[model samples]
Target: MTPPRRFRAGRFLDAAAVHAAADANPRLRRFMRTVAGHGDAGEVRARRLLEHIIRHVIDDVGDLHLGNAVARLERIAVLRERIAGILDHVLEGGTLPEGVRVEALGESFDQLRTEMRELSRPRDGIVGDAPLRLAEDAAAYADSMLREFEAGGGAAGLHSEPAAAVNDAFRAMPADRQAAVRRAAALEPQALWRAVASETEGGKRAAVADLETRLGGRLTPDELSRLRTAVDDLGVARNRGLQVSQARLAEALARIVDPELRAVVAGGDVWLTQQLALHNPEALATLWRRFRDRGGRADDGPGFRAYLRHDMVTYGRGVLGEYTAAFSLSSIELFLKGPDANVKVAGTDLVGIGHDGWVWLVDDKSHRATSVGGVSALTDNLVANLRRDAADFRDAITRLQRDDPGFTPDPRILDAISRMEDAAAEIERINRRGSAATRPARISRALEERRLRLRVTSAAGEVREITQALRDLGLAVEPTGAPVPLPPTGGR
Candidate 1:
């Protein structure tokens, strides 16, 4: 058979009726409190019992099903009966009657009645929670009863509440159900108060504090405080962000490298600071999670929103430090690829593609790249190679002019070469300045010019022009007037 279809309208009406009953009677508070502490099986059973009680309580006192409801209550009345059995067993064991059997069961009934009354009452808005006073009271009362019973009768408190609770529970039902429920509740009054109180403190505050600290101040006071109170109550609520800014920083720290890049990154505190500066909270959160989960790498750029005024150079260097040696080698490789491509030199990582290049070799942590013969050694080597290539090109051009004097090459080619040389010079100046902000424009433009030349200029012409350009641009070039040799392949 299909489970009962949830009638939204009926549920709404039923809820309203439950609210009405709780508001009108104080006994509902006791009932809810008792039911809360029940074990899973007991709680489930109690929930069913409460639902039945609520339906009966509101079922017009004269309903035809009233008699059946009373009979049903009698069938499910286990709490009182079970406690009575325990009390009898304890007496038989020759163990002095511990008040726990009395107080615990007694308070359980009290809570049941109180909760029932609270739920029965209606409020302006539907208040799912009844007052917590009864739970606290029940707990204290249960504690006292257990202690007295443990002492063997000197302090066995007379638990009048269990009988009263059962009485109240039945009384709250339709009047027709009360007599039958009363008859079925066969609880022993002597051992109803015996119960072990549970401990509440769980050392969660320190754990919460430690977690919050690691979050790098990303967690709000409200969020941290909420976690500190109870882990079970945590919710994935909107506006309640889980702070992971520090985690992102740690991630970013493991990926980037390059000194100039490090310098660019060092000026700022963290990616989160950059994010805050941009005033983009969503981007900040996304970058944080990405950094935390994927790590800080150049390829991971898609996940992290670049909001830094300095191009997140510090963050980049932190990431670079993770593979400092690898990045330095890669920098040299890039610089060796071409003389005209913009090259960025910073820390150990070299960025840029041509003559206008930025070299970044991150050594912020190791500080090795900044030292002499470190990244600077690589830079000097690159400059010297450019000089050698220039000398070779000049000699080749001189050979062509001599061997084929009739070859009056296009002056436009020479002009283009001259322009490239000029750009290279500008790039060198920018490099000396070591300012990433002022360099990209010149570097980017030079590469565009180089690309144009690469397509338009002759190979020999390009080599000749680039070498002369390098020499003119304040770099150490090979001696002039060197002899030019024929191509090794004898093919221009």
Candidate 2:
């Protein structure tokens, strides 16, 4: 038989959490104070139980099935109240009829796990989720209970508002369904409060100082000031959109020079959508699930949004070998074939056909910001290579002119080479100036042209290593002094 047709969660407004909230009022607060500092073995157990309940049970694990979720929360409440009762008796300095019955208490959890296993099992044609609003409803209801409980001086309101929640849950349903639900609820007296579970913290934080650590890899050495100024919430700010400014994104993009790789980072118009689909699909799972289930993006916390940006920036790190082929302006046959035709292995970025049956190969000297210092080592080698290539081309033209009296070099090509030589000289001067620099507040203000200079280096060393492998394979490879243009930038 076909499973129930998937319905939008809005069809059923957020219902009461089938489970009630745990009360941590003044009684529990006093209990915590006594135990948290130093108390007997029983106080220690109570404190441990409260911590476990707070960390695990109330955590909102975000289950897809309502029954499994309800069971988990329902049993957690049972456990909390049981501890509350024990604490109450201990505070009164009286021996209770029943203390913490380890076996009996553990049974509630065991039952929850069993029901979760049973409910979580795959059913025929049942690729459906419970109403997403249910989790919202649970959390809201619990918060309301907490507010009311604290307002009542904590000691009171333990049993307050019990009937209202179950009643409200069924209120959205038809009269007949409401009657049936209330009849089935069979609620107990003095057992009030419940809420739904959610996923773990998704890189959200209370302070800007926290972001520096989590996002340390993505940021430049002196990027905290820009990031602090970027958003007051430290990138957790959410209203109707998960918007990361294009400027901030470009700043986070580091010193990437490749256009395709830059596109992967900046993500152009769609921003994070394309980048997530390309590299980290799982990062967008919850958001997509919400879209599928509710046809809307929930006000999911900043943690959720922050995690998304983190994922995009994390994988957006440029690949040395793959992007080397991506920037080819020639008919390069990539060794590592991918959906994108331009992707190629590292050493052979641009391997295309040359005239007279000669094979043309362009090896990328990809460097990462992590590996290279960006200014000194990069420009030193780059300046040397370009000058040598220009001189060799000039000498070759001179020799050709000697043979053919009317031999004239293409002024456009000669100008291109000369213009590049001049550019290289300017690059050298800038590199020297950058060698001894002071730390600036912002990247834009710091070394205005640092990214441009850093873009000069590409992945090297790999090609030289491949030289021995080729010689071993009897290829007798010889180095060429051909006029190659400036190489691409470093990989991740």
Report lDDT (CA) for all predictions: 0.35, 0.37
Candidate 1 lDDT: 0.35
1-492: candidate 2 lDDT, tens digit per residue: 111223223223111121112222666645555654473533223433343333222223222344345555676577667656665876797664364565654665676555455555633112446423323466765565455434644322111122233334334444544332232222311111111110012212232344344454554543434334333221222210123433545554544443433443343323344344434545445444544365333443333344455433332322433354334323323222121223222222332222322222333343233232222222335456445555755787889999998988766446535643664576456555653332111222222222111122232222222333222212221222221333333111
Tens-digit lDDT track of model 1 for 148-258 = 334542211111112232333334555334332222222311011111000112223333344445554554565444433323222111001122233454444334343
Model 1, C-alpha of 222: deviation from truth (Å): 77
Once superposed on the true structure, which residue ranges of model 2 sit more than 4 Å away at CA? 1-235, 238-351, 360-467, 474-492
> What local lDDT score does residue 472 receive in model 2, on the 0 to 100 scale?
24
TM-score of 2: 0.19
Q: Model 1, which residues run further than 4 Å from truth?
A: 1-387, 410-413, 434-441, 449-492
Error of 2 at 384 (Å): 38
Best by TM-score: 2
